[model samples]
Target: MTSSTPLPPEGHGLPQEIIDTIIDTVSDSTTLKACTLVRHDWLPRARQNLFCELSFPPATLRGEERWRSDYEEVLRSVVMDVAHSNIKPPLSAAVRRLKLHFTDTSSELGFLEITSQLPFKNLHAIELLDSDLYRFEDHDQDALFLFLRENPSLKELRLDGVNSEPKKFLHFFSRLAGLQLQLRSLYLNDFFGYHDDYHEPESTFLHSLPLLSNPPALQTLALHDVSRTEADIFVIPLLTTPSRFFDLSCLQSLEFKFPFIESDEAILKMCGATVMRFTIKGIAHRIHDGVILEKCFHHLSNLVRLELHSVHPDRHGIVLLLLEHVPILRRLGQLSMQFVKAPSRVRDSSPPYTSAEWALFGEGVDSKVDQLMQTSNPSLKHITLDIPCSWKNVTEERIREYFPKTNSKAVLEVFRIQDS
Candidate 1:
């Protein structure tokens, strides 16, 4: 008898759902491109992942002239593809997020105009980075406004390193308020208001917007690296008066980097009832304030996830004091403590802690963990320690030695990070 060779299995033998699940796990663009050529049935999902996010000029590009030229070319190619692609829904329809870097230069205004005209039906998030909106001409500002207005599906907006005059910024929000888009998340980092009137209170800028009285309900809000004036003027007012821009009662996540103050305490009192996730970033020494521990956690009964990010070496016993306030959170499940090294110019130049000092500190942390385990029941499922790269080994060893119970239970996780 002659032996016959068996043929390779067909790709169609696997269910489409399984194929999609496998493709979803692939993140490399090169691999995704290769997957598209393997079977026609895989093309839609592959293209969706490939075009889900569109960034102008590419993040790796440097130099203004080079990036600007690349931006124009990419924009042109995208527009042409959208208009002429043979695919049913078109490649642009798969885009869900856009990241655009803008400048005050006149040439950039032209780019903005062209961007405003692109058709992105499913776009939901927009990030304006390193932009100086204060210098935009009337037409340029109108173009941006039109772009935002056209995207009714937009639900997340992030402004990073963006500057605008107080009046102009307020006007922008006022127009956005008119759109009545249901924004679910907003992040403002290194945002500034530029004007000669430094004496004016910050609240006036936000309070003046009549249309913002009933703004969209946001689920997540983040304010980072904001100046003191901006915090006092914008952040405090927004947090304290949730009805103006957000419904704090429905807010699920809040992240901010601010020195604890009476206003911040008041914010906790308001939103603490429902917020399930909370993150606070500050200098290590200032994070464990008396009032915060005494007054804040009591109101956060619903908190499920808590992240304390310290921008300096936490040698001042923040762990014990902060953890002392955790027992009140009956629903707490995840806790993340991060120690970030500050910049060299501002960092303390003290010598590394001696082994004796590490042992003492570890004991305190261990005792706190013991109390949490005894009192928190099974709700405390995971604990994470994010230490700076330089101290990762020492910290992990000490933590594992001191927190033997937690380590053995596999509830402890330690990570080495370059920066926070």
Candidate 2:
């Protein structure tokens, strides 16, 4: 009798070490599926890469099943076993990260059941995306709390497109307020005050932070869509008394998705001692006149690193306006504005610092490099820009005209624009 077993293709016959490398290198699902067929040896690693972190199709679509793509089928089989009490812990254990975007209430109910059954011990990260989080949020507080208590190791959470009365969430966060979970990173984006609350309370949720039993000091926190909250209560009062329960004193890095004039100042005023990295995105404003953010930047009293990214390069002075506000006067900084992440189409034309393509954005940015360089009592060691190659034809003497290399401490001028 002839042996009927088939052999893997020649390249697939490579040493197990090299095959493992190939499996480990590719994270895209299609490639991992192809690897699974190559040899039995690579199947474990390939499946690990393929199934570890899963994203359902956008829940914004009409049906719940629509979110399940390729690997979700495997997950369903494991969920069925777990639900039946013939649980295979290792199967659901593979799912360390899970993201659920719910288009409707039924989807939330379905997933909560899945969550309860899975008892995913390794589930350390969870993301909930729902515009109508209100329907399920308050209704399922007990189950949600059970999910949290069961998975005490959960360290990161992201809530996006959530608009609710603060009180509804307090029930959930109150459970979390105990600070039992080692939650280090939190992202609250597009959270709005309840639209029906014709009488918006002075600050119900903002005051609840510190009360969470001195909630775990989050190392990373990002606050987005501050405008959704009535007044600046959500962002500004974080550092003040009576409402300071949200416990940000352990913060190491913070990002502002929506720019507020006094927002940065508010955090520093409350807990500047611990924050070393600060980032602000002003992309919210199409016409970013420096008037509002000028004071915002001025409040950078403490911090070793600051990142300021703007959408309107036309208002290049917006960054300079911020640098002028550094009241500390003599702290070292390397201001980099050309790092704006424009799309490939925009990058093709919008050279970092100087671009006429941006003339359409607004009047092109003011040449405030000289103005920023001239700001008094400066500790600026370097300034970086992405000026156009076309603009590089200017004589070196003219370059020196604006940036004289004669400060007591010579400031380094770095540009992507090549020498003419």
Candidate 3:
């Protein structure tokens, strides 16, 4: 007699390669877990994909928690296991990205040692976020220098609350000059102060960055606070090097969040029409002007997204000027304006000039924005208007009226009266 036909396999039983593709597309961790249970054959592929990104909450110390006492006992037992050394093998082999967050100075060296043991040769990206950083003592500085020297294959580097003498930063960067590691992105956040608290030799480390023998293949550079002065001699190297980056075609995003007292011309020229995303924060009135920015936009016709913060009303004329000058900006997808309050005068008028106020806002800002939208750029999508919470003169009604409704089906949103 013929045997009963076997039941059809459960699910599609997708090929192993197709499963791997599905894993790669997912960015959220929760979804990865569900995928793992699909089948025994899919387990290894799911695990490898999920563990590729390792995030360390470095702020938590070894003995900070009372519960950790029990944890430590268990941890020690696991470390002493016969196969403990093999633990790094599978993890290191799959990890391509690492995000580290540290809160204390005491654990800096310990953190370094832990990272050194990890297999980082295949690592491509690293993001460092430190809530509290130690003012580098002599030894701490040396250890950091050594860590960078060892991790020469790094393609992307991000740092937050990193403290060091400017000279030391330059000294460390100088060593990596010849390696020419494929560094495509650089992000740095440092405490901004008017004075130089940490002293170093006369040889300023800030200048030494551009002088590196072979600049890393940088495509995206973000500097939160590099300097405070308006001196061109100091700001030129950082702002004027887009063309120099390897595969200049890849350079698209640039950010200058520091307080700079200098010209925007070089920055405009360096971008030279190809820059797509640009962000500028903390502008000092005396050093920069609207006209320069207008010219910059003229040159950088490709800019698609712009974020402007801490700008004075007088400087607003610049953004308006830019809207008129940059033809390509009509395609701008997102625009954010972070405005500071204009000092108020005690107006004793009986009735507030409601009509005048509306007219003024409409003629000045609203009209300019409408004109920009009329331009042919199809990409202009979202606009966020951030105004001080205390500005009583610009009422909610006036703001709503100023933002003309577009037929784009909320594809372009306009927000007003954001919290200061």
Candidate 4:
């Protein structure tokens, strides 16, 4: 009776596994910030969410910082402390993917220079969009190289919306050829914005080889808005056969997104055994004519994903379409599609035979599925469709209505391409 009441039983916290599951589900930044602040244990998970996709807002920092007059401004410390080594490891170490998006000729080029040089050992992927930082005349380019050299862990590199000439573009290949690590995925889109409109009489860059004496390690190589002739004559030959030297056998997924498909199907066939994913997006008249696929695809018995999508935005919109890059697949997967040449205009977009357009799209889709049956039996299945029309005639709703139902043919519920 004199004994004090037994102390209330201690309550153990949730199991660590369960706590991680809870943290993983909450994806929003604001909530993640709150979760990190709540306790130190949760900080690791929260920081992972926050820093994993460290994307700089593209438009917000587009223009230059206005000049300030007072000495007080100097003391304010305008230098970004983001990538500094002094920053907390919990934040810096957690970063896995970094996407730095900017506009053309932006004034804050210095910001990009400083932020990119920071050391983050765990960084696995980097995407630089819409910035011409590759200009060798600038220090920022050197800084970018330094950052790349430091991050040996990088698995993927995507350079999209970069506008430069062929000679400047070749420099990128030359540098990448020197990297020690094998990249799982490399996507180059409009790197020059070099269009048929300019139509240079001679693409001298193709005739010349990259400075690399050896091939760069690559699993997935996607070329967008690049010239068809150059890809066949220069890039492919130099990379694959290399003029009586070693073959670039590292390629697994190879894609081309030029305005037209020329007689390069043989190059694709040469890599057929190793190339799991094959994609081509553009007018695709060659594919529609049936010669390209007939000649190229039958050889790729191990091919997993085959995506042929329209590239013209007015008639079609494919954002990295057809190439659903599974960086680690190096992760095998399956896919297929046929090609169709449809005019961008149909009697001034009055929805003329909305069914016909759907019919044509369906035919292309169904044929691809059939063609891949032998090759991609064990590959990952993904159908990415680029929505090129901005509702000029048919709405997104209208497009969805005619999609094929592939449920009976395979495990796939739909035979059609799904918008991502």
- Best-fitting candidate, scored by lDDT: 1
| Model 4 ranges off by over 4 Å | 1-14, 21-40, 57-79, 83-90, 106-116, 138-140, 193-215, 229-234, 241-247, 258-260, 263-267, 279-289, 307-333, 336-406, 415-420
The Cα RMSD of model 2 versus the native structure comes to 8.7
For candidate 4, write residues 205-313 as lDDT tens digits: 4445444455445677777775564454334544554332224465787887643354346556566678877776664332343345455555565666656555332
lDDT of 2 by residue, 87-179 (tens): 232435656677765545444444455555564666678887764544555436656667777777778888887765545554445456564
Which consecutive 10 residues in model 3 have the weakest lDDT in total?
346-355
- Model 1 superposed RMSD (Cα): 5.9
Q: Could you tell me every candidate's TM-score relative to the true structure?
A: 0.79, 0.66, 0.62, 0.62
Give the TM-score comparing model 2 with the true structure, all chains together.
0.66
Candidate 1: residue pairs that collide: none
Local distance difference test, each candidate = 0.70, 0.54, 0.54, 0.53
For model 2, give the 10-residue run with minimal summed lDDT: 359-368
Which regions in candidate 2 have their CA more than 4 angstroms from the true location?
1-49, 58-78, 81-91, 107-111, 131-133, 137-139, 195-214, 231-245, 261-264, 284-299, 317-320, 326-334, 338-367, 370-420
Q: Which candidate do you rate higher for TM-score, 1 or 4?
A: 1
Residue-level lDDT tens digits of model 1 in 330-406? 88999887776533333232334344334334436655765576656469888887767655335567556667777
Better of 1 and 2 by TM-score: 1
